[model samples]
Target: MTTDILIEHRRDIADLKQRIKNRRLQVLGLFGTPIVLAVVLLVWAGLKISFWLHSDTPSAINNILGGVVAFLVLSVIVQLVAEFSEDFDVWRDRKTSVRELNLQLSLAEERHILEARRRTPPSMDRQASYKERLPGEIARLRYESQHYRRVHLLMQWLLFVSSSAISAVTAWYDPPQPAKGVLIGLGFTVTVITAAAGYFKPRERAFNLQQTADSIEQHATALELGIAPYNAMEEASNLELFATTVEGLRADQRMREQQLDQPQQGQQHVI
Candidate 1:
Protein backbone atom coordinates (compact mmCIF):
# COMPACT_ATOMS: atom_id res chain seq x y z
CA MET A 1 0.00 0.00 0.00
CA THR A 2 2.78 2.42 0.90
CA THR A 3 4.65 1.50 -2.26
CA ASP A 4 1.62 2.19 -4.40
CA ILE A 5 1.00 5.58 -2.81
CA LEU A 6 4.63 6.52 -3.23
CA ILE A 7 4.61 5.49 -6.85
CA GLU A 8 1.47 7.46 -7.65
CA HIS A 9 2.79 10.61 -5.97
CA ARG A 10 6.15 10.25 -7.66
CA ARG A 11 4.46 9.81 -11.01
CA ASP A 12 2.34 12.89 -10.56
CA ILE A 13 5.35 14.99 -9.54
CA ALA A 14 7.36 13.74 -12.47
CA ASP A 15 4.54 14.59 -14.84
CA LEU A 16 4.12 18.09 -13.42
CA LYS A 17 7.84 18.80 -13.41
CA GLN A 18 8.17 17.69 -17.03
CA ARG A 19 5.28 19.92 -18.05
CA ILE A 20 6.92 22.83 -16.20
CA LYS A 21 10.19 22.15 -17.99
CA ASN A 22 8.49 22.18 -21.37
CA ARG A 23 6.62 25.39 -20.61
CA ARG A 24 9.82 27.08 -19.37
CA LEU A 25 11.57 26.38 -22.66
CA GLN A 26 8.63 27.64 -24.71
CA VAL A 27 8.25 30.82 -22.63
CA LEU A 28 11.96 31.51 -22.61
CA GLY A 29 11.96 31.36 -26.38
CA LEU A 30 8.93 33.62 -26.64
CA PHE A 31 10.33 36.21 -24.23
CA GLY A 32 13.94 35.86 -25.37
CA THR A 33 13.00 36.62 -28.97
CA PRO A 34 11.94 40.13 -28.03
CA ILE A 35 15.03 40.76 -25.91
CA VAL A 36 17.21 39.58 -28.80
CA LEU A 37 15.45 42.05 -31.12
CA ALA A 38 15.74 44.75 -28.47
CA VAL A 39 19.49 44.18 -28.35
CA VAL A 40 19.61 44.66 -32.11
CA LEU A 41 17.74 47.93 -31.67
CA LEU A 42 20.16 49.11 -29.00
CA VAL A 43 23.03 48.37 -31.35
CA TRP A 44 21.28 50.37 -34.04
CA ALA A 45 20.90 53.24 -31.57
CA GLY A 46 24.62 53.08 -30.73
CA LEU A 47 25.46 53.45 -34.42
CA LYS A 48 23.09 56.38 -34.74
CA ILE A 49 24.56 58.07 -31.68
CA SER A 50 28.09 57.45 -32.97
CA PHE A 51 27.30 58.96 -36.36
CA TRP A 52 25.50 61.91 -34.80
CA LEU A 53 28.66 62.73 -32.89
CA HIS A 54 30.78 62.54 -36.07
CA SER A 55 30.47 65.90 -37.98
CA ASP A 56 32.69 64.37 -40.72
CA THR A 57 29.84 61.99 -41.76
CA PRO A 58 28.24 62.80 -45.12
CA SER A 59 24.58 64.05 -45.23
CA ALA A 60 23.32 61.43 -47.74
CA ILE A 61 24.84 58.57 -45.71
CA ASN A 62 23.20 59.89 -42.57
CA ASN A 63 19.84 60.15 -44.42
CA ILE A 64 20.16 56.49 -45.48
CA LEU A 65 20.94 55.52 -41.89
CA GLY A 66 17.86 57.41 -40.69
CA GLY A 67 15.74 55.40 -43.13
CA VAL A 68 17.21 52.19 -41.77
CA VAL A 69 16.29 53.19 -38.21
CA ALA A 70 12.65 53.91 -39.14
CA PHE A 71 12.39 50.60 -41.00
CA LEU A 72 13.73 48.69 -38.00
CA VAL A 73 11.20 50.34 -35.66
CA LEU A 74 8.33 49.29 -37.91
CA SER A 75 9.77 45.77 -38.12
CA VAL A 76 9.45 45.36 -34.33
CA ILE A 77 5.65 45.02 -34.58
CA VAL A 78 6.03 42.05 -36.97
CA GLN A 79 8.20 40.27 -34.42
CA LEU A 80 5.79 41.05 -31.56
CA VAL A 81 3.49 38.38 -32.95
CA ALA A 82 5.95 35.66 -32.11
CA GLU A 83 2.95 33.49 -31.50
CA PHE A 84 3.10 30.50 -29.17
CA SER A 85 0.34 29.10 -26.99
CA GLU A 86 0.19 26.82 -23.97
CA ASP A 87 -2.92 26.06 -21.93
CA PHE A 88 -1.11 26.64 -18.66
CA ASP A 89 -4.15 27.85 -16.76
CA VAL A 90 -6.13 24.69 -17.38
CA TRP A 91 -3.30 22.33 -16.41
CA ARG A 92 -2.23 24.33 -13.37
CA ASP A 93 -5.78 24.48 -12.04
CA ARG A 94 -6.24 20.74 -12.47
CA LYS A 95 -3.00 19.98 -10.68
CA THR A 96 -3.88 22.40 -7.87
CA SER A 97 -7.20 20.64 -7.39
CA VAL A 98 -5.46 17.28 -7.25
CA ARG A 99 -2.99 18.53 -4.68
CA GLU A 100 -5.76 20.03 -2.56
CA LEU A 101 -7.62 16.71 -2.62
CA ASN A 102 -4.49 14.94 -1.45
CA LEU A 103 -4.16 17.41 1.41
CA GLN A 104 -7.79 16.97 2.44
CA LEU A 105 -7.47 13.21 2.29
CA SER A 106 -4.33 13.27 4.40
CA LEU A 107 -5.99 15.42 7.04
CA ALA A 108 -9.12 13.28 7.04
CA GLU A 109 -7.20 10.05 7.48
CA GLU A 110 -5.26 11.60 10.31
CA ARG A 111 -8.47 12.57 12.09
CA HIS A 112 -9.93 9.13 11.51
CA ILE A 113 -6.84 7.48 13.03
CA LEU A 114 -7.09 9.78 16.06
CA GLU A 115 -10.74 8.96 16.56
CA ALA A 116 -10.00 5.25 16.27
CA ARG A 117 -7.30 5.45 18.94
CA ARG A 118 -9.72 7.17 21.33
CA ARG A 119 -12.41 4.48 21.04
CA THR A 120 -13.09 2.09 24.01
CA PRO A 121 -11.39 -0.81 22.29
CA PRO A 122 -8.62 1.35 20.88
CA SER A 123 -7.28 0.01 17.59
CA MET A 124 -3.53 -0.47 17.28
CA ASP A 125 -3.63 1.20 13.87
CA ARG A 126 -2.06 4.63 14.36
CA GLN A 127 1.34 3.50 13.13
CA ALA A 128 -0.17 1.81 10.13
CA SER A 129 -2.31 4.83 9.43
CA TYR A 130 0.56 7.31 9.61
CA LYS A 131 2.75 5.08 7.49
CA GLU A 132 0.05 5.04 4.87
CA ARG A 133 -0.26 8.81 4.59
CA LEU A 134 3.41 9.83 4.89
CA PRO A 135 4.32 9.02 1.31
CA GLY A 136 1.51 11.07 -0.16
CA GLU A 137 2.38 14.12 1.95
CA ILE A 138 5.99 13.95 0.93
CA ALA A 139 5.12 13.56 -2.73
CA ARG A 140 2.69 16.45 -2.69
CA LEU A 141 5.19 18.76 -1.00
CA ARG A 142 7.95 17.86 -3.45
CA TYR A 143 5.66 18.66 -6.35
CA GLU A 144 4.47 21.95 -4.82
CA SER A 145 7.99 23.18 -3.98
CA GLN A 146 9.32 22.56 -7.46
CA HIS A 147 6.15 23.81 -9.10
CA TYR A 148 6.33 27.16 -7.30
CA ARG A 149 10.02 27.44 -8.10
CA ARG A 150 9.20 27.23 -11.80
CA VAL A 151 6.41 29.76 -11.46
CA HIS A 152 8.74 32.26 -9.80
CA LEU A 153 11.24 32.04 -12.62
CA LEU A 154 8.63 32.22 -15.38
CA MET A 155 7.19 35.41 -13.92
CA GLN A 156 10.64 36.99 -13.63
CA TRP A 157 11.28 36.40 -17.31
CA LEU A 158 7.89 37.78 -18.27
CA LEU A 159 8.54 40.95 -16.28
CA PHE A 160 11.91 41.31 -17.95
CA VAL A 161 10.57 40.86 -21.48
CA SER A 162 7.72 43.33 -21.09
CA SER A 163 9.82 46.00 -19.37
CA SER A 164 12.72 45.63 -21.79
CA ALA A 165 10.44 45.81 -24.82
CA ILE A 166 8.87 49.03 -23.53
CA SER A 167 12.27 50.66 -22.97
CA ALA A 168 13.61 49.54 -26.34
CA VAL A 169 10.64 50.82 -28.31
CA THR A 170 10.33 54.28 -26.76
CA ALA A 171 13.95 55.13 -26.02
CA TRP A 172 15.47 54.15 -29.35
CA TYR A 173 13.17 55.80 -31.89
CA ASP A 174 10.66 58.60 -32.53
CA PRO A 175 7.59 57.04 -34.08
CA PRO A 176 4.58 58.70 -35.77
CA GLN A 177 1.88 60.14 -33.49
CA PRO A 178 -0.39 57.05 -33.60
CA ALA A 179 2.51 54.66 -33.17
CA LYS A 180 3.78 56.76 -30.26
CA GLY A 181 0.34 56.49 -28.68
CA VAL A 182 0.54 52.69 -29.04
CA LEU A 183 3.98 52.91 -27.46
CA ILE A 184 2.47 54.58 -24.39
CA GLY A 185 -0.29 51.98 -24.33
CA LEU A 186 2.32 49.25 -24.47
CA GLY A 187 4.12 50.79 -21.52
CA PHE A 188 0.93 50.84 -19.46
CA THR A 189 0.12 47.25 -20.39
CA VAL A 190 3.57 46.05 -19.43
CA THR A 191 3.36 47.90 -16.14
CA VAL A 192 0.02 46.31 -15.29
CA ILE A 193 1.14 42.79 -16.17
CA THR A 194 4.44 43.09 -14.36
CA ALA A 195 2.68 44.50 -11.34
CA ALA A 196 0.23 41.62 -11.33
CA ALA A 197 2.98 39.02 -11.46
CA GLY A 198 4.99 40.65 -8.67
CA TYR A 199 1.99 41.21 -6.46
CA PHE A 200 1.62 37.39 -6.22
CA LYS A 201 4.97 37.02 -4.43
CA PRO A 202 5.69 33.62 -6.01
CA ARG A 203 9.40 33.78 -5.17
CA GLU A 204 8.84 34.11 -1.43
CA ARG A 205 6.03 31.57 -1.44
CA ALA A 206 8.22 29.12 -3.35
CA PHE A 207 11.01 29.44 -0.81
CA ASN A 208 8.63 28.98 2.11
CA LEU A 209 6.99 25.90 0.63
CA GLN A 210 10.39 24.44 -0.24
CA GLN A 211 11.64 24.88 3.32
CA THR A 212 8.48 23.30 4.76
CA ALA A 213 8.81 20.36 2.40
CA ASP A 214 12.41 19.80 3.41
CA SER A 215 11.43 19.88 7.08
CA ILE A 216 8.63 17.37 6.47
CA GLU A 217 11.00 15.09 4.57
CA GLN A 218 13.13 14.86 7.71
CA HIS A 219 10.15 13.39 9.60
CA ALA A 220 9.02 11.31 6.64
CA THR A 221 12.44 9.73 6.20
CA ALA A 222 12.78 9.01 9.92
CA LEU A 223 9.34 7.44 10.07
CA GLU A 224 10.03 5.38 6.98
CA LEU A 225 13.34 4.03 8.24
CA GLY A 226 12.50 3.84 11.97
CA ILE A 227 15.52 6.01 12.76
CA ALA A 228 16.61 7.80 15.96
CA PRO A 229 14.40 10.44 17.62
CA TYR A 230 11.53 8.41 16.18
CA ASN A 231 13.16 4.99 16.73
CA ALA A 232 13.22 5.09 20.53
CA MET A 233 11.17 2.68 22.73
CA GLU A 234 8.45 0.35 21.46
CA GLU A 235 6.71 0.53 18.07
CA ALA A 236 3.71 2.24 19.64
CA SER A 237 5.84 4.89 21.28
CA ASN A 238 7.73 5.53 18.05
CA LEU A 239 4.61 5.83 15.94
CA GLU A 240 2.93 8.06 18.49
CA LEU A 241 5.89 10.44 18.52
CA PHE A 242 6.00 10.31 14.74
CA ALA A 243 2.34 11.20 14.55
CA THR A 244 2.86 14.16 16.89
CA THR A 245 5.73 15.44 14.79
CA VAL A 246 3.77 14.93 11.61
CA GLU A 247 0.83 16.81 13.05
CA GLY A 248 3.00 19.77 13.94
CA LEU A 249 4.52 19.89 10.50
CA ARG A 250 1.12 19.44 8.92
CA ALA A 251 -0.29 22.35 10.88
CA ASP A 252 2.61 24.59 9.92
CA GLN A 253 2.29 23.59 6.29
CA ARG A 254 -1.45 24.13 6.31
CA MET A 255 -0.99 27.62 7.67
CA ARG A 256 1.53 28.35 4.94
CA GLU A 257 -0.80 26.84 2.38
CA GLN A 258 -3.62 28.95 3.72
CA GLN A 259 -1.48 32.03 3.32
CA LEU A 260 -0.79 31.03 -0.26
CA ASP A 261 -4.48 30.47 -0.91
CA GLN A 262 -5.58 33.88 0.36
CA PRO A 263 -6.00 35.63 -2.97
CA GLN A 264 -8.47 38.21 -1.76
CA GLN A 265 -6.13 39.50 0.93
CA GLY A 266 -3.30 40.00 -1.63
CA GLN A 267 -1.98 36.45 -1.90
CA GLN A 268 -2.58 36.35 -5.64
CA HIS A 269 -0.13 34.32 -7.75
CA VAL A 270 0.33 34.24 -11.48
CA ILE A 271 0.96 30.48 -11.42
Candidate 2:
Protein backbone atom coordinates (compact mmCIF):
# COMPACT_ATOMS: atom_id res chain seq x y z
CA MET A 1 0.00 0.00 0.00
CA THR A 2 2.83 2.38 0.87
CA THR A 3 4.63 1.53 -2.36
CA ASP A 4 1.48 2.17 -4.34
CA ILE A 5 0.99 5.51 -2.61
CA LEU A 6 4.62 6.42 -3.24
CA ILE A 7 4.17 5.54 -6.92
CA GLU A 8 1.07 7.71 -7.08
CA HIS A 9 2.95 10.57 -5.43
CA ARG A 10 5.79 10.21 -7.92
CA ARG A 11 3.35 10.30 -10.82
CA ASP A 12 1.60 13.31 -9.34
CA ILE A 13 4.92 15.14 -8.93
CA ALA A 14 5.81 14.49 -12.57
CA ASP A 15 2.38 15.63 -13.74
CA LEU A 16 2.57 18.74 -11.57
CA LYS A 17 6.01 19.67 -12.88
CA GLN A 18 4.83 19.32 -16.50
CA ARG A 19 1.74 21.35 -15.80
CA ILE A 20 3.78 24.05 -14.08
CA LYS A 21 6.13 24.21 -17.03
CA ASN A 22 3.20 24.61 -19.44
CA ARG A 23 1.68 27.35 -17.29
CA ARG A 24 5.02 29.20 -17.23
CA LEU A 25 5.13 29.04 -21.04
CA GLN A 26 1.57 30.30 -21.27
CA VAL A 27 2.41 33.21 -18.97
CA LEU A 28 5.50 34.03 -21.01
CA GLY A 29 3.46 34.15 -24.21
CA LEU A 30 0.78 36.28 -22.58
CA PHE A 31 3.29 38.91 -21.42
CA GLY A 32 5.83 38.56 -24.24
CA THR A 33 3.43 39.52 -27.04
CA PRO A 34 2.74 42.92 -25.52
CA ILE A 35 6.46 43.54 -24.82
CA VAL A 36 7.35 42.67 -28.45
CA LEU A 37 4.52 44.82 -29.82
CA ALA A 38 5.60 47.77 -27.72
CA VAL A 39 9.20 47.47 -28.93
CA VAL A 40 8.04 47.33 -32.55
CA LEU A 41 5.89 50.43 -32.05
CA LEU A 42 8.84 52.31 -30.51
CA VAL A 43 11.08 51.40 -33.45
CA TRP A 44 8.39 52.46 -35.93
CA ALA A 45 7.94 55.78 -34.15
CA GLY A 46 11.69 56.46 -34.16
CA LEU A 47 11.94 55.66 -37.89
CA LYS A 48 8.96 57.92 -38.67
CA ILE A 49 10.53 60.79 -36.75
CA SER A 50 13.88 60.35 -38.48
CA PHE A 51 12.27 60.27 -41.92
CA TRP A 52 10.13 63.33 -41.14
CA LEU A 53 13.18 65.29 -40.01
CA HIS A 54 15.11 64.59 -43.21
CA SER A 55 12.17 64.95 -45.65
CA ASP A 56 11.48 68.20 -47.58
CA THR A 57 8.07 66.99 -48.79
CA PRO A 58 5.11 69.04 -47.43
CA SER A 59 3.01 65.81 -47.20
CA ALA A 60 5.47 64.29 -44.71
CA ILE A 61 3.73 65.81 -41.69
CA ASN A 62 0.36 64.54 -42.92
CA ASN A 63 1.85 61.11 -43.53
CA ILE A 64 3.15 61.07 -39.96
CA LEU A 65 -0.31 61.95 -38.64
CA GLY A 66 -1.84 59.12 -40.73
CA GLY A 67 0.74 56.68 -39.35
CA VAL A 68 -0.13 57.70 -35.76
CA VAL A 69 -3.84 57.09 -36.46
CA ALA A 70 -3.01 53.69 -38.00
CA PHE A 71 -0.96 52.79 -34.96
CA LEU A 72 -3.83 53.71 -32.63
CA VAL A 73 -6.24 51.62 -34.70
CA LEU A 74 -3.83 48.65 -34.61
CA SER A 75 -3.49 48.99 -30.85
CA VAL A 76 -7.27 48.91 -30.40
CA ILE A 77 -7.60 45.86 -32.66
CA VAL A 78 -4.85 44.06 -30.77
CA GLN A 79 -6.45 44.87 -27.44
CA LEU A 80 -9.83 43.63 -28.68
CA VAL A 81 -8.29 40.42 -30.01
CA ALA A 82 -6.56 39.82 -26.69
CA GLU A 83 -9.80 40.41 -24.83
CA PHE A 84 -11.84 38.09 -27.02
CA SER A 85 -9.29 35.27 -27.19
CA GLU A 86 -9.27 34.55 -23.45
CA ASP A 87 -12.12 34.24 -21.00
CA PHE A 88 -12.12 37.01 -18.36
CA ASP A 89 -13.09 34.51 -15.65
CA VAL A 90 -10.21 32.24 -16.58
CA TRP A 91 -7.77 35.13 -16.45
CA ARG A 92 -9.09 36.18 -13.06
CA ASP A 93 -8.82 32.62 -11.75
CA ARG A 94 -5.22 32.11 -12.99
CA LYS A 95 -3.69 33.28 -9.72
CA THR A 96 -5.90 30.86 -7.80
CA SER A 97 -4.91 27.99 -10.08
CA VAL A 98 -1.21 28.88 -9.66
CA ARG A 99 -1.53 28.93 -5.87
CA GLU A 100 -3.38 25.63 -5.80
CA LEU A 101 -0.84 23.95 -8.07
CA ASN A 102 2.05 25.18 -5.92
CA LEU A 103 0.38 24.00 -2.73
CA GLN A 104 -0.54 20.59 -4.13
CA LEU A 105 2.94 20.09 -5.58
CA SER A 106 4.53 21.00 -2.27
CA LEU A 107 2.22 18.65 -0.37
CA ALA A 108 2.88 15.79 -2.77
CA GLU A 109 6.67 16.30 -2.49
CA GLU A 110 6.52 16.39 1.30
CA ARG A 111 4.45 13.23 1.41
CA HIS A 112 6.90 11.55 -0.95
CA ILE A 113 9.86 12.50 1.26
CA LEU A 114 8.12 11.29 4.38
CA GLU A 115 7.16 7.99 2.79
CA ALA A 116 10.65 7.48 1.37
CA ARG A 117 12.23 8.03 4.77
CA ARG A 118 9.76 5.70 6.46
CA ARG A 119 10.40 2.95 3.93
CA THR A 120 14.17 3.41 3.59
CA PRO A 121 15.16 1.38 6.69
CA PRO A 122 12.99 -1.64 5.90
CA SER A 123 14.01 -1.56 2.19
CA MET A 124 17.79 -1.44 2.61
CA ASP A 125 18.46 -2.84 -0.85
CA ARG A 126 22.16 -2.22 -1.53
CA GLN A 127 22.21 -4.05 -4.85
CA ALA A 128 19.13 -2.21 -6.04
CA SER A 129 20.66 1.13 -5.09
CA TYR A 130 23.95 0.23 -6.75
CA LYS A 131 22.21 -0.71 -10.00
CA GLU A 132 20.11 2.44 -9.89
CA ARG A 133 23.20 4.60 -9.31
CA LEU A 134 25.34 3.29 -12.19
CA PRO A 135 23.84 5.54 -14.85
CA GLY A 136 24.22 8.64 -12.69
CA GLU A 137 27.82 7.71 -11.85
CA ILE A 138 28.59 7.21 -15.52
CA ALA A 139 27.01 10.56 -16.40
CA ARG A 140 28.98 12.39 -13.68
CA LEU A 141 32.29 10.88 -14.76
CA ARG A 142 31.67 11.72 -18.42
CA TYR A 143 30.76 15.30 -17.54
CA GLU A 144 33.85 15.71 -15.37
CA SER A 145 36.01 14.20 -18.10
CA GLN A 146 34.64 16.62 -20.66
CA HIS A 147 35.12 19.54 -18.28
CA TYR A 148 38.77 18.62 -17.65
CA ARG A 149 39.33 18.11 -21.39
CA ARG A 150 37.98 21.60 -22.14
CA VAL A 151 40.22 23.15 -19.47
CA HIS A 152 43.25 21.32 -20.87
CA LEU A 153 42.56 22.52 -24.42
CA LEU A 154 41.92 26.06 -23.26
CA MET A 155 45.17 26.18 -21.28
CA GLN A 156 47.14 24.77 -24.24
CA TRP A 157 45.66 27.38 -26.60
CA LEU A 158 46.38 30.18 -24.14
CA LEU A 159 49.97 29.01 -23.75
CA PHE A 160 50.46 28.89 -27.53
CA VAL A 161 48.90 32.31 -28.09
CA SER A 162 50.95 33.90 -25.29
CA SER A 163 54.22 32.39 -26.62
CA SER A 164 53.37 33.63 -30.14
CA ALA A 165 52.63 37.10 -28.80
CA ILE A 166 55.98 37.16 -26.94
CA SER A 167 57.81 36.14 -30.09
CA ALA A 168 56.01 38.75 -32.20
CA VAL A 169 56.67 41.49 -29.63
CA THR A 170 60.41 40.79 -29.47
CA ALA A 171 61.18 39.79 -33.08
CA TRP A 172 58.68 41.67 -35.26
CA TYR A 173 59.06 45.16 -33.75
CA ASP A 174 60.65 47.10 -30.87
CA PRO A 175 57.53 47.95 -28.83
CA PRO A 176 57.26 50.83 -26.29
CA GLN A 177 58.14 50.23 -22.62
CA PRO A 178 54.49 49.66 -21.61
CA ALA A 179 54.03 47.26 -24.51
CA LYS A 180 57.25 45.42 -23.56
CA GLY A 181 56.05 45.14 -19.98
CA VAL A 182 52.76 43.73 -21.20
CA LEU A 183 54.66 41.22 -23.33
CA ILE A 184 56.72 40.20 -20.30
CA GLY A 185 53.46 39.73 -18.34
CA LEU A 186 52.18 37.45 -21.12
CA GLY A 187 55.36 35.39 -20.92
CA PHE A 188 54.96 35.02 -17.15
CA THR A 189 51.34 33.97 -17.66
CA VAL A 190 52.48 31.36 -20.18
CA THR A 191 55.07 29.96 -17.76
CA VAL A 192 52.60 29.74 -14.86
CA ILE A 193 49.90 28.16 -17.05
CA THR A 194 52.39 25.66 -18.44
CA ALA A 195 53.49 24.64 -14.94
CA ALA A 196 49.83 24.25 -13.85
CA ALA A 197 48.96 22.24 -16.92
CA GLY A 198 51.93 19.94 -16.46
CA TYR A 199 51.07 19.44 -12.81
CA PHE A 200 47.36 18.80 -13.41
CA LYS A 201 47.72 16.64 -16.52
CA PRO A 202 44.08 17.39 -17.38
CA ARG A 203 44.20 15.66 -20.74
CA GLU A 204 45.48 12.38 -19.32
CA ARG A 205 43.01 12.56 -16.43
CA ALA A 206 40.13 13.20 -18.84
CA PHE A 207 41.16 10.29 -21.05
CA ASN A 208 41.53 7.85 -18.14
CA LEU A 209 38.30 8.96 -16.48
CA GLN A 210 36.30 8.77 -19.70
CA GLN A 211 37.77 5.33 -20.45
CA THR A 212 36.79 4.09 -16.99
CA ALA A 213 33.27 5.51 -17.27
CA ASP A 214 32.80 3.90 -20.68
CA SER A 215 34.08 0.54 -19.42
CA ILE A 216 31.80 0.64 -16.40
CA GLU A 217 28.78 1.63 -18.48
CA GLN A 218 29.50 -1.10 -21.03
CA HIS A 219 29.83 -3.77 -18.32
CA ALA A 220 26.65 -2.58 -16.62
CA THR A 221 24.76 -2.76 -19.92
CA ALA A 222 26.11 -6.25 -20.64
CA LEU A 223 25.15 -7.41 -17.18
CA GLU A 224 21.62 -6.04 -17.52
CA LEU A 225 21.09 -7.80 -20.85
CA GLY A 226 22.77 -11.03 -19.62
CA ILE A 227 25.27 -11.22 -22.46
CA ALA A 228 28.45 -13.33 -22.70
CA PRO A 229 29.74 -14.28 -19.21
CA TYR A 230 26.61 -13.06 -17.47
CA ASN A 231 24.46 -15.20 -19.80
CA ALA A 232 26.18 -18.41 -18.70
CA MET A 233 25.56 -17.82 -14.98
CA GLU A 234 22.56 -17.93 -12.68
CA GLU A 235 21.04 -14.60 -11.66
CA ALA A 236 22.79 -14.43 -8.28
CA SER A 237 26.10 -15.49 -9.76
CA ASN A 238 25.70 -13.03 -12.61
CA LEU A 239 25.08 -10.21 -10.15
CA GLU A 240 28.14 -11.19 -8.11
CA LEU A 241 30.28 -11.26 -11.25
CA PHE A 242 28.94 -7.88 -12.32
CA ALA A 243 29.72 -6.36 -8.93
CA THR A 244 33.20 -7.84 -8.90
CA THR A 245 33.91 -6.63 -12.44
CA VAL A 246 32.66 -3.13 -11.72
CA GLU A 247 34.68 -2.91 -8.48
CA GLY A 248 37.80 -4.12 -10.30
CA LEU A 249 37.35 -1.45 -12.94
CA ARG A 250 36.83 1.16 -10.22
CA ALA A 251 40.00 0.00 -8.41
CA ASP A 252 42.03 0.27 -11.61
CA GLN A 253 40.71 3.79 -12.13
CA ARG A 254 41.67 4.75 -8.58
CA MET A 255 45.20 3.37 -9.14
CA ARG A 256 45.50 5.39 -12.33
CA GLU A 257 44.40 8.52 -10.43
CA GLN A 258 46.96 7.81 -7.71
CA GLN A 259 49.66 7.48 -10.34
CA LEU A 260 48.55 10.73 -11.94
CA ASP A 261 48.77 12.47 -8.56
CA GLN A 262 52.45 11.54 -8.10
CA PRO A 263 55.52 13.23 -9.66
CA GLN A 264 56.79 11.94 -13.01
CA GLN A 265 59.67 9.96 -11.42
CA GLY A 266 57.38 8.54 -8.76
CA GLN A 267 54.85 7.56 -11.40
CA GLN A 268 57.60 5.88 -13.41
CA HIS A 269 58.70 3.93 -10.32
CA VAL A 270 55.08 2.81 -9.75
CA ILE A 271 54.74 1.73 -13.39
lDDT of 1 by residue, 187-214 (tens): 7767876776656767767777677778
Model 2: pairs clashing at backbone N, Cα or C within 3 Å: none
**Per-residue lDDT of model 2, residues 1-271, tens digit only:** 7668778889989998877776665566556656766776676567668775576535665577557667666765564454455544333224435667778789989989998888763322555557778898889889989999999999999999998999888876688887789888998999999999999999999999899999999988888888977796466667667777888988999999999999999999999
**Deviation of model 2 at 41, angstroms:** 58
- Misplaced by over 4 Å in model 1 are 1-123, 260-271
At residue 50, give the lDDT of candidate 2. Answer: 78
List the global CA lDDT of all models: 0.65, 0.78
Best by TM-score: 2
Weakest 10 consecutive residues, lDDT, candidate 1?
Answer: 84-93
How do all models score by TM-score?
0.48, 0.54
